[model samples]
Target: MFDTIRRYTARLRTSERAQPQGTVERRAHNLFEAAAVYVAARVEDDQDRIEEAAAWVSPEALSFGVSELACRAVVALARERDESPGAVARDLLGLPAA
Candidate 1:
């Protein structure tokens, strides 16, 4: 995650330098949006889009967003599987059952 953030930060800086000041009106992509796009991009194996989405928010915010997304996913999977969130998470990661 940190490495992803670092690469995105570099790309963001480069893009910012390339753009002119006060020309384009860009709406800020919140942490949640960034997290969603980042995850979807990863699932689709789109590295560039993942990096671009990661640049939408501060690294700390993006981290929090990603963590929140993971928790939500675990909960949803747990519900679908009729299992506990911890068990679902561990199963997803192939960890030994606790």
Candidate 2:
């Protein structure tokens, strides 16, 4: 089982390395839209789209884009709801108000 898992992991890594260099950059360039799609997927509870968007870019780049999207969303929601950004974020995330 361990060997099988290792082989699968290696294959995935090898495929990632074989991808064209600009592929990640090109995908990252459209991260804003990707991030929007990611957020919409979350809101709509669409797991497949979420995974698809996540697979389009490197994890680090996706993390950055998601953070940027969160900040923008907080700002927009705060303005629309006449609340603080932090409050809006917490509310949207179903967290206790801070």
Candidate 3:
């Protein structure tokens, strides 16, 4: 899983770097995608990929992306485990069940 996340993030970075100067809108979209990739790396516990992804976007943008990913992940895990989203999130983070 970690290897996969690393490879995916590397590809994203490479593609972004290869692109010529893009419009503000396109850059913003890329940043969001980068953030999502960062979140995936985090979920996979891949520190290297997380750092690589972080370098692709601003700290603020990455934070927002991570928050968005966390919410979505919680919902999905909740459904899979037949538990509340809050519970799933807490459990995933090793927190006491809420």
Candidate 4:
């Protein structure tokens, strides 16, 4: 779960940087939206692991001050990615593999 959150965060950051300057905020929001797709895509992943990963993608948000909506988006993206948490987060956030 932690890995998945890290991947997602990395991907989102990459995607944000890829965008034009001054669009980081929008990119962040969009990345959050994409998160839903990614999560949805990962359905075979372990639920227990995912639940444990909640620490990373906590709905309460993280230190970055990411909004609850963004967190939900991340989870949604993970699901979209078939529950392949890591891959989905990366896809949504635009982060490369470790």
TM-score for all models, in order of appearance: 0.74, 0.58, 0.56, 0.28
Candidate 1 residues lying further than 4 Å off, grouped into runs, are: 1-22
The TM-score obtained by model 3 is 0.56
Name the regions of candidate 2 deviating beyond 4 angstroms.
Answer: 1-29
For model 4, what is the alpha-carbon lDDT of residue 15? 79
The per-model lDDT (C-alpha) reads 0.94, 0.83, 0.81, 0.56
> What's the ranking of the predictions by lDDT, best on top?
1, 2, 3, 4
Error of 2 at 54 (Å): 1.5
**lDDT tens string, model 1, 1-98?**
99999999999999877977678868899999999999999999999998999899999998999999999999999999999999999999999999
Query: Candidate 3: what lDDT?
Result: 0.81
- CA-RMSD of model 3: 14.5
Clashes of each: 0, 0, 0, 33
Q: What residue runs in model 3 are displaced by over 4 Å at the alpha carbon?
A: 1-29, 43-48
In candidate 4, what are the lDDT values of residues 1-98, reduced to their tens digit? 99999999999989767867665452133434333433533455656544543444435443233455456667787777666667766766789865
| Model 2 local distance difference test score | 0.83
How big is the RMSD of model 1? 11.9
Q: What's the distance in Å from true for residue 81, model 1?
A: 0.9
- Tens digits of per-residue lDDT, candidate 2, 1-98, equal 99999999999999877987667534343776677788789989999999988777777777888899889878998999999998888888899987
The TM-score of predicted model 4 comes to 0.28
